[model samples]
Target: MSLSLNLPESLPVDVLAPDALEFDRGPTVSVPVRSLRLGRSPRTGGLNDEHCRMLAAAGEALPPVIVHSGTMQVIDGSHRVRAAVLQGRQEVAAVMFDGTADEAFVLAVRLNLVHGRGLLLSRADRTVAAARLVTSHPYWSNRMIASLTGLSAGTIGRVRGQLTAQTGPVGTRVGKDGRSRPVDGSSGRMKAYELLLGDPSASIREIAKRAGVSPSTAHDVRKRLQAGEEPVPRHRQVPPAQEPAAPERAVALPARSEPEREEPADPEAIIAALTKDPSIRYNNIGRRLIRWLDGCRRGVAECPGIVERVPSHNIDSVAALAREYAHAWGEFAAALEERNREAC
Candidate 1:
């Protein structure tokens, strides 16, 4: 039941913890330069030399870097550590963190995002990383990916759709909440069939509703029971329900023609296949982008740091360009997704 990432397990932290505990920040500790492990940085681009130089001049006055408790590898404050090294310091301040390696990487991304260096990755690199993460973490939603990468959810959704379409179908059942997990729907179907057997007057639709399956599937199950076939419940995770008691009264069923060969369509599978088309994916991305843009407009949301940073010269021009670029991003990601789907 552990959730493992496709990351190197060389670090001492747990690579497959089922759930990462809430992050705990331990008091600052000083470690010798020789003991420090320059942790693997997830930054797409290289470190900013100018930013490091500035931090070096500031010396130990800057905040301590964060390190994994077990591995003693630096997770944040890479530049500060570098600066400390340049300052000929034997020891630097660090705050030890206790968490899984995946959580450590996520924290690193957030730290790099707003610490004057901006995002440590280019937009294209970020997009690729986002798609890779979605494919690896099927249980994760687009919002979860966005939270870790600080990328738009629209982009994450497009990437996820592309990956799903490319891979055909995942074995696990995907629910409306966009999470995939093994499900047992069999016991409920068996119970429903038993109920229908006890009471010939029971409605098929009601049986289907109680069983949490499609009406057509319920009909098929009923037909099988009528044909004197012992019910073999499908092995799936079924919902909690009261076990149906076999009644003292049993009714004989009418003999019917051979059961129809038509199988009930799984709504989840059908929707996934339907959305594999290029046009549909693009339309989805565009709609989400438009919604995000609506919130970005002045009146819709509070002027965040991004809006505050708009240059003084030709304010409207920059705003217009940003809008166009965003629209273009939506279009590009959708089209790329379409290509991947077709390849699959």
Candidate 2:
């Protein structure tokens, strides 16, 4: 799930701030409940007494609470902490989170959304949480905040508009992959065009660095300029008075209209065809490859059912692993294609 960028050596590498996934991976320890301070919770109504009783009944089976190491503030699992107290436990298991209070709060919202055992955050609560996040993490893209708050990106976008109207607009947004991209790429494109006019010989990476855009974008600008076309694509070119709200709409509409474009070959048909090949059917390596491909196809086909069966608590971890495997498979496919090209 990592993206590679040809960024300048002077630019710092971006890493996601401490989040629920990081908290899940952190080491657990016994922290005295008395020593922990109750941090601000995302729940609008605060802790539910009935939920605490339910967790208390689970006794020692309750999972570790997440605590901010710096402030000794309870970042998540407040109900679990209350439950442990009702059980007369002196200390509860905890995972220490070393991050700012704002980051800890964001982690709390994310953990509450993902965990199955506790009462989920209400829609109103989630909306409030999303609004707070828009203020705290102004640079975070809508999808990134939406993923944490369990809201749609569109909802988050609306929330951002309402919140930022008072706070002012952000120039850049940091996406889930932790890369900061310009909110309005038109400016970046114009900058790139200017750079190209000054020195057409400049490398794409260098031009991108100076123009504050991605290398791919700089390359596009250079190509467009060379062709005597506008540096910014027509769809992306917005009047200075208006915001570029739907730059992708123009490009996306044509894709739906042209539905007659050929679809990919069916995986089952391909596998069946490969199985019938004499050279493949009789060879050990070929048979193994066919079996592997078939297994993958089956796995992909059953993804909906598989997702339904995944335990709620483990869903985040499972999804992360699945994405990692899918990325690896993409790399494997690319390598095999390279080998085939060499053979040809």
- Write one digit per residue (lDDT tens) for candidate 2, span 1-344: 11112111211111244443445445677777788888487877777787587667754466677777767788777888898889998888777776677877877776665442355566677889999989988989988887677777778888998887766888889887878887779878878888898999999999999998999999988877766666777656668576433322123212122222211335764576466434456569979989999998988989988878899999999989998998998899689757644533
**Model 2 spans > 4 angstroms off:** 1-34, 115-117, 193-210, 219-239, 242-344
Could you report the Cα RMSD, in angstroms, for every candidate shown? Answer: 16.4, 17.8
Q: Each candidate's lDDT (Cα)? A: 0.56, 0.72
The local lDDT score (0 to 100) that residue 55 gets in candidate 1 is 58
lDDT of 1 by residue, 1-344 (tens): 12123112332333223122112133566766666677466654456566577556643365667777666677776777777888888877766667766666655654543331222444554666676566656666556667555576667767777888754544445443555533334555677677787787888898888776667767877876776543443232233374333333333344444433212223332233233222333467745644454444433335465687878886899789878977987898689767644533
TM-score of each candidate? 0.44, 0.56
Query: What lDDT is obtained when candidate 1 is compared to the true structure?
Result: 0.56
What is the Cα-based TM-score of model 2? 0.56
Instruction: Assess the local accuracy of residue 162 in candidate 1 as a C-alpha lDDT between 0 and 100.
Output: 80
